[model samples]
Target: MSWYQHWISFAKRLVHVVAKPMKQNSGQGGVMVHPYRGYGSSREVFVMGRVFRQAALGRAIPRRGVLRDTADVARRIFRRGLADARVDIRIGNNQLCITTDRDGYFDAQLPVSSALPVDVSWHRADIMVHAKGYPPVRTNVEIYVPPPEADLLVISDIDDTVMFTGVAEKLKMLYRLFVRKPHRRTAFPGVASLYQALYRGKSEKAERPILYVSRGPWAIYEMLETFFQLNRIPVGPILFLREWGISWRKPWPRRAEAHKRDLIDRMLALYSDMPCILIGDSGQHDPEVYTEVVKAYPGRIKAIYIRRVDQDPKREQAIQRLRDELAHTDCELVLAADSVLIAEHAYAQGDISARGLQAVQRDVDEQQNDPA
Candidate 1:
């Protein structure tokens, strides 16, 4: 192709470079974006916005902000990072704002005890001229719960295990899987009830502690929490993978996996000497990851429960491997139809009372057995 033709093609592709803005309606306040783009800048922008939300809510909340570029790069970045961004109100019934600033920062408010959808967005200041459209940013709200020490640390997966859709919903899966952020997620049958039981510590001798460890990016933490609170799922600390964006084949291909492993290690460190139970689905790496944890810390891990969302040969193989590895250990591996089965096991293992465990188990059984 001639030089002019090549230039034309390049321009076409550049024009086609799509920047999708995510707008999540959950109550939590944090920026959500693809995994690669999330770790550096968007997370910081979201945390900054959360301060505005907390001020409106009349309570102080722990907030964190990260500048997207590296320290060296940050120094060279635009002086007014996010300064060009603007938050404008009035978009039909919903009050909305958009940012076109260098730093991509925007502010929003969430009144205390108030439940309303707050929307914020980021776009290039130059791109606004065409008015093609501005993609809204995604935000997740984090709800704080007093630490539940000695309680059952009910860590579970958000994908197929609780939500009916396996591998997460395709339309939304990218947001969860690649974006590494939280958005609206589906609730699996009896998951809410089970989480409630675990969170409330309704069972005798069982601590009601809930923790979520998922492949979703950290950007979605607020969205995940909001979904939980909206659906009334048990609440707790949620661990997520950071978006490093570096291609695996390149210098940092293993960064994503390494980041996850580091996160898992930190989780174990926090719960060091703390007896805990694990809950997850069979859809993804949860099986293998959980197994490794059990093997690494024998008695510390109370139980391993995998939600049978679908049939997968590889998952089955992994399950078998976990069994083989745990052959000599006391850890129990179970395929629960729903949350109750886990509760039942906990009750039997003296984690909860017979009656309380039986009640939750029955509820899940009925939900799974229901024709609707």
Candidate 2:
């Protein structure tokens, strides 16, 4: 072809490329705001969310078809992170803007100038997230305003601690995660009642905040939510650790240890006056991590409970060493085999009432009879 003809063909191809839609990371469309439960004292409010276009990543799992379920499982197990999106949020009269950094997550700690009701445990506000291409998305956000009656806060790990997640065994963990519905999954005996009692704390009406931290990817957030609801556990902010991505500038996604520690630190700093109870299983880094947290803030931790999930002798010894190490501190480390032990300790500390202890015992007995 002549030079002019070749030039025209090149220009046409360029136009086609420019006009095509951007390659998307996930299948679904539309922008979404996934705000985690935020808690604050009366003077200020803190809120957080991930700004992203919907990918329908877990959409097929709940639809009840073999092929669709298989696809959803695959998506969840190998889910990709959608990141680096711009977002805007407005809480009450305070407006702030933040940009997601390679994780599609944004959080703002805004001040609450308006007066909050004295008795309520939660404060509601509208949170709006916007991206350049997608329309502005709005969602109801709750800033947990802890009541003055709250004695302490609870931060627990979900995997293997309360839920029977074979976290130490990769294949088994994947199999269980893919095959079961949220309701079908098992919660440890009496853990729900224990959590309820902790949520109610010293007073029967006090709804003290409970935060859940997990090492799993965000793809399973919906299923976890369903699981919490089905089990009648008190709902709180579900924080997840990122496990994808490695690069020259940022060598890893939110590192698991750092994520857990940073989140715990944030909570501790936010509620400086209230102590925290740390709970996790021995299958992973609970002992080591909780020990580090205790060391970081010596008097701030009220108690630490590491469930004995692993039967290994060395693991038990390590946890026992940690317990001994904390002997002089204000906190107590209890490595227990059942929720009964945890409930008993809480009762002794006046964290739960005698009636609440009885409820926990009843639930534990029922779970033994029928784990269904």
Q: Best lDDT goes to which candidate? A: 2
Candidate 1's TM-score reads 0.53
lDDT at residue 34 of model 2 (Cα atoms): 65
Per-candidate clashes, comma-separated: 27, 0
**Pairs of colliding residues, candidate 2:** none
lDDT of 1 by residue, 291-359 (tens): 888887768777888987767777787787787878788887887766767777766787665555665
lDDT of 2 at 235: 77
Off by over 4 Å in 1: 1-149, 172-185, 202-207, 239-241, 244-260, 369-372
Worst 10 residues of 1 by lDDT: 50-59
How displaced is residue 137 in candidate 2, in Å?
A: 2.9
The TM-scores, one per candidate, come to: 0.53, 0.78
